[model samples]
Target: MSGPPPAAVTVHAPLRRRVTVQGVVQGVGFRPYVHALATALDLSGNVTNTPEGVVVEVEGDPAAVARFCDRIAVDAPPLARVDSVHHQEVPATGDSAFTILASRADGPTRALIPPDTATCAACLGELADPRDRRHRHPFVTCTHCGPRFTIVTGLPYDRDQTTMAGFPMCAGCAREYTDPADRRFHAQPVACPDCGPRLALLVRRADEAGQPSPVTDGDPIAAARRLLAGGAVLAVKGLGGYHLACDATDPAAVERLRHRKARGDKPFAVMAASVEDIEPLVRLDPEERALLTATTRPIVLLRRRTDGPTVPGGLRPAEGVAPGSPDFGIMLPYTPVHHLLFGLPGDPEGPRLLVMTSGNLSGEPIVTDDAEALERLAHLADAWLTHDRPIHVPCDDSVVRVCDGRPLLVRRARGYAPLPLPLPLEVRPALAVGGDLKNAFCLGAGRRAWLSAHIGDMDDLATQRAFERAVAQLESITPVRPRLLAADRHPAYRSARWAVRNAAGRPVVRVQHHHAHVAAAMAEHGLDGSVPVLGVAFDGTG
Candidate 1:
């Protein structure tokens, strides 16, 4: 009876797996996502950030473990770029719950640092909501967005390794940071108004002998708005470096900035609050509009409309903003500070459009040090709107243009640097010190090459120092230790000279200028270089 007592019921043993995930995983909420996934599948596991990448160990039913492994890459966090995932079966640990462990630092660092991202919509909502605790917080950021490359000082990206190290979390933020259910969980730069960086407005006081004096009486943002409304240039400290901001609608202000910087009629980029704000000034196809509002928020070149809308007092983007140019380089607000600069609704109206140019003198690096900014930009800026946070590296704004319905990079920095490009064929480790102009160097190993952010021309000692610092920083996080060096063949090139000087007995390969240009194009298109191809090179000299 009853089929011989159900044939003596049998149970299968639990399965466990140890997994390793690499690529853009450290700072982008990968651990929280992993914890959530494991918990949802009723599995027990621990996830942690390591110098190498993210690692996870899970024990559960065989089917559930397989699902966990599959979803780790397929449904990773929005900002995470999971390049590879590996998992192997191991003995079950019988752990009761899933957890996120502190980052492990004892290893060779191969983790990819994420580029700084524009503020996400959720943070922007909190910024605008009066009922929210972070209302009007200039540093509103979550794990999804905000500073990464520029703020990172070391690997296994943690709060202590970032510029936010000095700003200890308050009780409320700490609660949010440790709770896996919360969005701010393990967000390195998480902060609230109660315990975060404060904004300060500085101006050169005649009584202080041209020294910058902080304004302690009124709100800094409101005071800054007034300065721009009065056609005064402001040196505003940003995520990476200082920006020289002025009312783009004011012709005198634009001309004053150009004259002060000795800019020779080169086009100046402008920042508006939204696409709608700039729609009247530029022709925006769907692709161009998407690019203008992308999370990276690069300066996009758009065809200018000759007959565009004018502001009150018949003010438009001044001719001095982009003299003799058919297009306007424009970008939307990328940071909470930038959004606050353009006032929120129901606040006093300020400059809806701003000339946000790099804060630098002619042929020099952008100013990152606050004291240095106060000294170097004193002659150019009428006021300084800065904060207490220190930028570890100087990154400039990236520039882009839409060509044939695709995004074409003109100057790759800020949003897109230190991200590796895949090579069609594997090659030995090497370091390429780029030309003297637009000196972004490269570090290559195997089939990948990592390019540094936009380091300025090598003519200035300051720029050369920046290049060296960037090279060292890039090498610290990557596995590439160059055994060979490449430089331009031009003997007078500063980049070449620096490469030869620092070769450390490694052979230095000199590449011809035009030939290198062709090779670069070929590499970009994934050509193997096995077949002969015709190439044409043209530049100012040619």
Candidate 2:
């Protein structure tokens, strides 16, 4: 038999604490979640977005307040990533209710903004449902999905600070935006067909004077698919930038794209409608499948099916797609527009797979500016399927490969920019200008280092200009004002030269390429130099 519980005693004193959270918290529904948590715990508090990250205040019983702080990261929204949370007891403010405050822009921005994510399951369901107002809408998004770093032009990541500012929300969207119960509440890129970015298709033709004339008019996705089926190359505007796409099955089309772009044997990435579509052509392990379908949607390199047909045979990818390589770089459709290209559910006549290569000439940075694409890619693209949503940053598609059942990132961009890498040791504000070949610069302060998105080879004049622009954009978002500069030791490397020329009054530290590579590996593993580790350098340079 259970005895009656003793009478509960009420605590008279109220406890208060302030918490400062860092990393990928802004534009990710952090404040609302904090509000809900604080309210549920019967705590009177306030939450606000700050440059350093989210700031929260809570006044309640000491135990409840502690639990509230502990569960913040554990119960954070799916898209909200909490890197670090710090709390300190403060004097009770005698608050009565929980509230969310306006964002503060005055602090040094150490807060890491999240990278763009793939369309979430909820958004995808709405995209395919005929009854949903956002059905087949190209720019459909929610708090758990859609653009972030690439679309963000300035700090304090809000709709007005992003490219989506041009499109105002309709009454329906506005309702969802304010409704706390709605998934899209406070989603920066939330919009619908009533007020959202629209696609436009343009075809190039020679005028009577033999000058190129671009004629714009068509149902963009349908027209682009039609052009692709007809062996025509289309320049497609993607989340981060443009992509040159064509039917992967058409050898002639692949060869034409290669010849026009002056690309050598470097393989192109193929975008399939789904994993089911590409399963027949490639061998996919559990890890490879996960990488392919991940929210980041990076191109994953997979071993080709050399030993005859796969389990469920369909059609094989054209030989021209990879040339000499034994692995195929593949990715699934990430954006709603990409899903539109393949058509809804059963209406099938279009190509199953597309050769989606970065939209640029061989040695240039990927094109993000629409006007520049028209002029520079005129010789390569026969048609253009573009949108009004401007990309504030030009980021190439990230590339990765599964080696020994683990993901190895080859080129980190697009879905992985502005996210800082944790360093083994704290350092002062410094900018590391990586080698000219792959040319990815890093801005570091304290223990966090942010690597710029792939800037392409710094040899090209256009690439150099792009490097400067990327640096400026990165500096705007990250509060690291580089007081010291670091560059490769190679005397003539363009990146090193750029460091010398642009160092202003800052000191430039030259690091040997081989030494730096060894150091990087050590740092990644958090080695403290207590023991000797063998390192081999094989960069292929004499």
Candidate 3:
């Protein structure tokens, strides 16, 4: 208490206010955190994540009201990302204890879904503690990370709305999840090895005849690591989809993976066990290392190490590992599975490093289904490290780099895409059709713009399906019946075609590809075309 209340102080009557928070405020454990805070402060109100942002209505004692707004942000949940909040006073009606309300349509423009974050320091410490049940467990996760947009199927991110819906939580984990003081409180993805999703290995049943099928039932992650130890190739499912994995040190394994995947030219990314392991394979300046290790865990393109062998035809069939390029895309393991595969320092059968590449038949969307990955990647892979967790959204790994010392996003998936960007211009709540390659769409309202996770090249039918599903899902959360729609000028753009096909009830704006890009940059930098500035528009075929 900051001194007892003044004896003569007449506490003003409590007022009611409706608050709207914009930015990446959904699917990151925000509503529950607010509920907890409000309950503790004895406030009566509710908060919900609408397509626009989080909408809140609160009424309580004057001091509690101040604390409600002020402390909520400071003590915000670890995974929740708050950008800007707007609140307005309204009529007050008597109410009970504050609670989290189900998300409803508040305005146009979808709230940005926070990207998957890395495990928190606290959770990691617990994972490494032998006294803990999940000590050194590979699948350990908390509110900070594990999965978010990648695993969510709908809004109001609850366990039932996630891939974890199938496996019911064990009694102990469930208890911790409900305890207010516990870190796992209301944690949607919480589970122990006993009640959590299981792992299984998929191998080609008839080798040359059929697709891959799981041979072993339990612990596919651990089994896959054992196979990798023997220098075998295994296709593993990741946050977005499947990734082809092999021992990094085994040149034979790497080369084999390339030949099987029919990759003629395109560099395969290497996942060093740790930041220290990366130094030998590539040169990492202090800044580069910092970006690589950030919570985003983006694949970073770094100049290759002078010590490693140059691209050679004789090298493991990674034939196209580098085509028309000089940089190598490298990243540290972002998921708990990747962490477990490259076992911590003391674990036996620990792999010092591994080669992890997208699971696909070159030029295809990453694989998500166990049967499909086996059938599709059979030759390219020796075995499958499959899990029971179903992927709701298919996002690829996001890649980035420092060009001229500024961060440049390359792939824009896993931990970046789907997170809304702040825009300078507030359009009539609309959808900004993204480009054809690494295709991602943006929906917005007010100053906030939500970008969908990377949708991959529009050429593949699978990618097209993903694009359609993504659009519907975003529309559900950001509830926008855009009075006006926007698309690219290019006639061949699948996105443009989609816009044309879907514009049954609205006005359509066909913006040139580069124009939208420039406009987006301008919006982000707060530029209002008062002064002329140099701009470059590049298109090879146009």
lDDT of each: 0.90, 0.86, 0.74
lDDT tens readout by residue for model 2, 1-542: 99999999986699999999887898888877888789889999888877789999999988899899899989998877788899999999899998877777887887778998898988889988999998889999988888988899776777888998998889999998877678787888998989998888878876785434544555667777888989999999998889999998888999999889888899999998889887777899999999999888999999887777332445566778899998899998889988889887755577778999999987689999988888888899998888889999888889999889988888888677778878888888999988887678999998888989898888899999999999999998897999999998888898888899999999999998988888877877787567898988778441
Predicted candidate 3, C-alpha RMSD: 4.9
Find the candidate with the highest lDDT and give its number. 1
Candidates in descending lDDT order: 1, 2, 3
- Against the correct fold, how does model 3 do in TM-score? 0.85
TM-score against truth, every candidate = 0.97, 0.94, 0.85
The TM-score leader among the candidates is 1
lDDT of 3 by residue, 1-542 (tens): 59877679676787887877766666666777777787888889888766577888889887877777887667776667677777788888888877666567445554666777777767777776788888756667876777887777766556777788898989989998867667776778888877887666876566565555557555666677778877788888888889988876676777778788887766788776667665655677777888888888888999866576433322221324554566778788787777777775567755665677889865566788766876777778888877888887777887888877777876677887676666666667888777777677888777667777667677888877878888887776564546667888888888788888888877779987777776766776787667675667665431
lDDT accuracy of residue 372 in candidate 2: 86
Q: Which ranges of candidate 3 are over 4 A from the true structure?
A: 1-22, 35-60, 86-111, 136-138, 207-213, 217-219, 307-325, 444-446, 505-508, 513-525
Per-residue lDDT tens digits of candidate 1, residues 1-542? Answer: 44555466666688999999999998899999998999999999799888989999999888899899889999999889988998898888899999988889988878899999999999999999999999999999999999999999998899999999999999999999999999999999999999998899988775546577789998899899999999999999998899999999899999999999998989999998778778778788999888878889999999988785554445478889999999999999999999999999889877888999999976688899998998889899999999998899789999999888889888888888768999988888999999888778999999999988788878999899989988998998888999999999998999999999999999999999888888878888899799898989985321
